[model samples]
Target: MDKKYSNKGLKIIAAEIQGSSKQAIGKIIEENNVGFTVTKGAQGPVSIAGIPHAVAFGADGKLIFKGHPASEEFKDVVREALRDVKVVKENLGGLVALGDVIEQRTWTNSEGVKMVAAVTKIDVDKVVFRLQKNGKIVPYPISKLSEEDQKLIKGMIEDE
Candidate 1:
């Protein structure tokens, strides 16, 4: 679904409210080859009573549709919602969105420990990353990362 609608400016975020652990969610994502963001231990804006539920919002952030994503009705609503959607590359509050899909990469620390994540937001002295192993968002001091990682992040920001 992400590959199909990402070009249409549709951001799909699936939240797992079933009390799944990070490791469990990560395994499921890897096994299913999920391309979109899957957050664990999080709740959506509305109340949900079942699994495999979906809620879509328009470009204006209003509730557009709520149903199973595999349903034809949901697909129709998405298509209609996307018909007038315009992709915006503008900055989000102080956060920088690296295009439609944030590029994930392997980052290393000074101790040689490595983690795969994507840069979602950057601060003056810190960087926020969305972990690839699990959909956990974390903020770390820029100085704690490797020198090479620091350069890469700085270059990305400068390019923006």
Candidate 2:
């Protein structure tokens, strides 16, 4: 796949086709012909809601924006989503989500404090875990963990 599209870490999808707006969209389809899939059958939001509307989905397939695709607000939202994706990738060394149930694990920190926790979120410079003892979410610096723990956590600080 072209990095121009894949590197963005998200795909653009036009979910509904109906109304007089199809004329203009048809023209675009003919001009671009970039192999976007099409369905003769009707699908999606069911109601027109409106025409020429845009929607954006994030890497995790959640809607991030809804408006005219060309609108500045839509573009700004996409830009921000992309930036967030990049930041996440850098922090986790890959993509990850917020509430995934990271398997239960125990680790001892450099100060010899052994903590058992389930992973919550991986931040720019810390690993957030829900401490099993008190169910409190806390951020632990990767550096503070024991070498064995750090190695184990590093491999899993991202999406399952």
Candidate 3:
């Protein structure tokens, strides 16, 4: 497999096609003259919500496509199938709605005092943390903390 597309962590979905539907997909592949292989397996859960199945399409034994229900290259086919369905616009901002408090523990320089903090706001470069006791907001530079400390802090916050 080509290293370029053979990401170990990449997710894939596989499905078995039979009858007329299989013939249609096969015709498309044959028309395109792209090499591919099919394998048999039990259906499994999909990482993407809307997608239900995933498969791998390889050319010359190298993976070129991956995703659920449709190979990456054939995603448009799946999209067209779902075109008629009305999809509700999800409020991305509402995913972590305000007042949905997540308790996090932090270490204070004043001593190694473990303090509870609330995640008020999170951004790419900085995080807004407020002391749970008095609600005092403090900003922490993400670069300042070591990876281990970050994990520790994250674990403490999620523990509660």
Top model by lDDT, which number? 1
C-alpha-based local distance difference test score of model 2 = 0.62
How does residue 62 of candidate 2 score in lDDT? Answer: 79
Per-residue lDDT tens digits of candidate 2, residues 1-160? 1134444444555644554366666777789774554333355553334666776766566777776766899877777777744323343333334453344467789888897877776654678788778989888888888887777666755444
Reference-based lDDT, residue 142, model 1: 86
Q: In model 2, state the lDDT of residue 69.
A: 68
Preferred candidate (lDDT higher): 1 or 2: 1
Residue 89 displacement (Å), model 1: 9.2
* Lowest-sum lDDT 10-residue window in model 2: 86-95
Residue 111 in model 3: shift from native, Å?
A: 9.4
Cα lDDT of model 3 by residue, 32-140, tens digit: 6634353333444323334344534332233333455434545654344334433221321222223323334554432344566756755556557777689788887
* Model 1, residue pairs in steric clash: none
| TM-score to native of every candidate shown | 0.52, 0.40, 0.27
lDDT of 2 at 52: 68
| Candidate 3 ranges with C-alpha deviation above 4 Å | 1-101, 107-114, 152-160
